[model samples]
Target: MPSANQAQAKVQKLRDQMAQMQASTVEQIAQLKAEAQRKYEELQLQFKTEVAAREVEVTRKYDELQLQLQNIMKMFQQSQNRSS
Candidate 1:
């Protein structure tokens, strides 16, 4: 049978191991949170960049369509003047 001192020593060792495991778990959680935040910011920036690019493209298309419409109106007016 183990003596009281031996039992106490075993208990202390177990306690130390448990404490180390807890500390390691806490550190890992902190690291994961930091990584998640970095990824979120990266994705947000990418989304904003894509949105800005699309806005510019849409504006360019709108301008092109407006110019085409104006050209058609001018051609129709010219035809009417020739008829008159």
Candidate 2:
């Protein structure tokens, strides 16, 4: 019942709508990728910060243990000298 020109115009309109939908989908994908990259970088920075803090704590504990060992050795030496 429709004229040939009218049918062609309807097809063109549907094609234009499809193109617009594709463009919108592509834009959304790009935005999601950018957000994911930003979050990954933030997590990496947090992990490095935590690792550095742990390293400092471990170094402090080692130093304290070394000092305690040195004090014990000195006491032993003093006792030996008194016996001699």
Candidate 3:
């Protein structure tokens, strides 16, 4: 059987190990949260950039379609004038 002093020392050692593990877990959690935040911000920026690029492209395409329609109308007017 172990002596009382030896039992007490063993108990103290176990307590110290538990405390160290708890501290390490807390630190790991903090690091993971920071990394997650950084990734979220980066993705948000990329999404905004893509949205802006798409908006510009859509606007350009709309303008081109409008111009083509106008040209067709003018051609129709010219043909009518020739017929008259």
The residue-level lDDT of candidate 3 at 39 comes to 100
- When summed lDDT is taken over every stretch of 10 residues in candidate 3, the lowest stretch is 25-34
Quote each prediction's TM-score. 0.92, 0.87, 0.87
Q: Model 3, range 1-84, lDDT digits (tens) per residue?
A: 999999999999999999999999999999999999999999999999999999999999999999999999999999999999
Give the per-residue Cα lDDT of candidate 2 at 63.
Answer: 100
The residue ranges of model 2 lying beyond 4 angstroms of the native Cα positions read none
**Model 2: lowest-lDDT 10 consecutive positions:** 2-11
Q: List candidate 1 segments past 4 Å from native.
A: none
Best by TM-score: 1
Greater TM-score among 1 and 3 belongs to 1
Clash-forming residue pairs, model 1: none
- What is the C-alpha lDDT profile of model 1 across 2-77, one tens digit per residue? 9999999999999999999999999999999999999999999999999999999999999999999999999999
Whole-model lDDT per candidate = 1.00, 1.00, 1.00
